[model samples]
Target chain A: MLFKNLFHHFGRYVIMLGSAFSKPERASMYYKETMRQMNDIGIGSLFIVCLIAIFIGAVTAVQFSYQLDGTLVPVYYIGYVVRDMTIIELAPTFTCLVLAGKVGSNIAAEIGGMRQKEHIDAMEIMGVNTAAYLIMPKVIAALIVIPMLVAVGAFISIIGGYLASVPTGVMADADYIKGLRSFFDPFNVTMMFIKALVFSFILTTVPAYQGYHVRGGSIELGQASTNAVVFSDILILVADYLLAVVLTS
Target chain B: MIRTEDIFKSFDETEVLKGITTEFYKGKTNLIIGRSGAGKTVLLKLLVGLLEPTSGKVWYDDTDFFALDRKQMRNIRMEVGMLFQASALFDSMTVEENIRFPLDMFSTLTLKEKRQQVDKCLERVNLEGANANFPSEISGGMQKRVGIARAIVLDPKYLFCDEPNSGLDPKTSIVIDELIRDITIEKNITTIINTHDMNSVMEIGDNIVLLYQGKLAWRGTNEDVLESDNATLQDFIFASPFLQRLRDAALKRG
Candidate 1:
């Protein structure tokens, strides 16, 4: 029964995505909506992304310095460790996890509210493709903006590591910069962008699907919003593990 | 004109509409009246292609609505307009923006032309100068007028209103009913309204279809409603003792 239900939902999700990616009625209207979503997703999320990235970098630097005490490992390796961690793992994974909570639930609630209000049905009767109109712009905006946000997050995290280690006499500023510049592979940056793109697709579409198919009243809408976040977070983590295995191996 | 042939809708094991065949004429106020669970909403949704009937057909003039491909269906839908019970005005937009949405999406009218069209619709709905107000800032009656304004903005050939008078006072309901009636006549558009308001029935029901227990139990005009001997129709129309007393007094006066 559980497997059947899972397959049913998976099938529905795929069909919903097919409709959402279909051709739009008016390109200009869609363009306007896309620009609005870009502003919301990009500008609205900058502060939270920066805050989380800085803390992740600082904590990692402090913990690594503690582990390196009275050991053969160089303290300057703190910079190396924080740089790689923030790029390969922290920036894409943690930032997306936070967004899955903030943006994912919000998309679900917004679309679900429209459903309850009959706004979607009204659009449909107007000869508008409601799925494409509502979901495509959001997906496009996230795809374009989320990678840039992740890039900014990674840059801020490196600066945070330097501040935590070098300013407090834990390491010299020159040594910390050297460690940051050392042994950096360009492939890691490529991997970071790849994860960002994939996570962006998952977070936006999963919540939109939840919102689009929502039925019943406020309680059902609330449940759909919660499920959107939960499912998006779970899928993002699973994708993170899979991407790590594939990209590293 | 819109016609349905043997329309049947079922959800899982329960059937909501059982072979409902009917016609709504062009340039007429057609009302679908029933109690809360009588499948009026399901039938309306099916007619608009929101839900496909399990076994049935809907026709807009000579076009078989369900037989058309996606693009063809959309072409037909472009000529359709709907007003929802809650008014369904996009809350994020001003009244003029809401009314102009269809024009923005489908028409190549210049911005000035669109604004003129919006003004004309607002005037038609007796809501002139409400162009800058948001739906939330308006009264319920004003919001319903906005919904009507938006519905007719595209010059749709067919209009559907799902409970246009649901929450209005009696006087306001009569005004809305009369407004819809006038629009139907002026545009020669096929208009279908789903409502249970008795005042709406007597005032604007040029044609009426009443469903009971998922089947068509009665069909007539506002004139027949008071005189019909159909037991089910009587039980429904005179369900309240106050209405029954009024009916008895009218009969005695006659």
Candidate 2:
């Protein structure tokens, strides 16, 4: 029964995406909507992304310094550990997980509200492709903007680690700088971007699908919003694990 | 003209609409009236292609609506307009922007021309000079008028209104009904209204289809409603004791 339900939802979700990506009626209208979504999702999320990233980097630095207090591993390794971890996993994963709650729920609620209010029906009868008009711009905006936010997050996280380690006597500035400069593999950045793109797609489209298919009244709408966040976070984690295996191997 | 051929709609295991075949003529106010859960809304949704019939067909004029491809359906939709019960105006946009949405999406008119068209529609709805107010800032009657303006902005050949008087006072409801009636005549468009308001029925109902338990229970005009002998129609139209007394008095006086 569970498997059947899963397949049912999966099939419907695929069909919804098919309609969402279909040819738009007007390119100019879509462009305007995309810009609005970019402003909402990208600019709306900057502060939270930056805040979470800094704390994650700081905690990682503090814990690693404690672990390396009397070890053969040099204290400068804290900088290296923080850099690689932030680049390879923490920045993209953590930031998007937060966004899955913030932006994902908002999208679900907004679109679900529109559905309940019959705004979607009105648009459909006006000859607008509601799925394409409503969902595509959001997906496009997320795809473009999320990666850029993840990049900024990664940079801020490194600075956070530097501040935690060097300014707090956990390590000397010279040693931390040496660790940061050493053993830098560019492939890690590629992995970060891959995760960012996949996570972005998951976060935006999941919520949109939830919203688009919502039924019933305000209670049902709230449920859809919650489902959007939960499903998006789960999918992002699953994709993260899969990408780590594929990209690393 | 819009017609449905044996339209049936089912959800899960329950059938909501059962073989509802009807016609809405051009330049007439065609009303679908029923008690709550009589499938009036479902029938309306099906007629507008919002819900696909389970085992039947809908025809927009001579074209089979369900048989059309996506692009073809969209092209046909360009000639259709719907006024939702809640007005469904985009809350973020002002009245001018809300009415201008359809033109902005589909019309190739320049900005000045679009504004001119918006002004014209607003004036037609008797809502001129109220352009900058958002839907939230307007009364329910004003919102419904704005909804009408938006619906007719594109000069649609088919207009569907879902309970245009749902939340309005009787006077406002009468005004909305008359506005819709005038527009139907002026444009010669096929206008189908889903409503149960008796005032609307008597005032603007050019043709009426009454549904009882998902089936077409009765069909006639306002003139026939008072004289019809159909038990289901009489039971529905005169459900209240006060109305039944009035009906009896009218029959005695006649």
Q: What C-alpha lDDT do the candidate models reach, one value each? A: 0.94, 0.94
* Alpha carbon lDDT at A184, candidate 2: 98
Which residue pairs clash within candidate 2?
Answer: none
For every model shown, what is its TM-score relative to the native structure? 0.99, 0.98
| C-alpha lDDT of residue B208 in model 1 | 97
Q: Distance from true position, residue A217, model 2, in Å?
A: 1.5
lDDT by residue (tens digit), candidate 1, B1-254 = 99999999999999999999999999999999999999999999988999999998999999999999977988989999898999999999999999999999999999999999999999999999999999999999999999999999999899999999988999999899999999999999999999999888889999999999899999999999987999988988888899989988988998
- lDDT by residue for model 2 over A59-135, one digit each (tens)? 88999999998889988899899999999999999999999999999999999999999999999999898999999
| Candidate 2 local Cα displacement, residue A200, angstroms | 0.3
Looking at candidate 1 chain B, the ten consecutive residues that score lowest on lDDT are: B69-78
Residue B167 of model 1, lDDT score: 88
lDDT of 2 by residue, B1-254 (tens): 99888988999999999998889999999999999999999999888888888989888888999999978998999999889999999999999999999999999999999999999999999999999999999999999999999999999999999999999999999999999999999999999999999899889989999999999999999999988999999999999899989988988998
> CA lDDT of A46 in candidate 2?
98
lDDT of 1 by residue, A1-249 (tens): 999999999999898889899988789999999999999999999999999999888888999999999999877799999999999999999999999999999999999999999999999999988989999999999999999999999999988888899889999998898889889999999999999999999999999999999999999999999999999999999999999999999
Worst 10 residues of 1 chain A by lDDT: A158-167
True contacts recovered per prediction:
0.80, 0.93
